[model samples]
Target: MEYTKLTLGIALLVAFAWILFRNSKRSGVLHALIRIDTIVGMIAGLYLVITAVHSLFF
Candidate 1:
C-alpha cells in the first residue's frame, strides 16, 4: 500500500510537471484545462506524500 501510494505520488508529480511544460504552447480553454489538471495533480501528489509519510511513521 505504501509503495502504491509512493508510486502514485511520483506519477502525479511527473504528470503535473508535464502539464506545466506542455501548457507553455497552448492557449484559451485548453490552457485553462491544463491549469486545472496541474493543480489537481499537485494536490493529489501532496496528499499521497503526506499519507505515505504518516503511514510509515505512525
Candidate 2:
C-alpha cells in the first residue's frame, strides 16, 4: 500500500515534467504544470504523513 502511494507520487511528477518540458511553444503550460504538481504533491505528501501518524497511534 505504501509502495503504491510512493509510486503514484513519483509517476505524477514524472508525467507532469514530461508534458511541461515537451511543450516548447508556450510558457503557460509551465505554470500550469507547476500548479498541478504543487497541489498533487501536497495532497500525496499529506496522505503519507497522515498514514504514518495513524499507524504510529494505532
TM-score of 1: 0.68
lDDT of each: 0.79, 0.59
**1-58: candidate 2 lDDT, tens digit per residue:** 6566556656665665565566534666556556665557556665665665565567
Stretches off by above 4 angstroms in model 1 are: 25-34
lDDT of 1 at 58: 92
RMSD of every candidate to native, in Å, equals: 3.3, 5.1
Worst 10 residues of 2 by lDDT: 16-25
Candidate 2 stretches with Cα past 4 Å from truth are: 25-58
Which pairs of residues have clashing backbones in candidate 1? none
Per-residue lDDT for 4 in model 2? 62
On residues 19-57, what C-alpha lDDT tens digit does candidate 1 reach at each position? 766676566545656577678888999899789878988
Q: How does model 1 fare in lDDT?
A: 0.79
> Each prediction's TM-score against the native?
0.68, 0.44
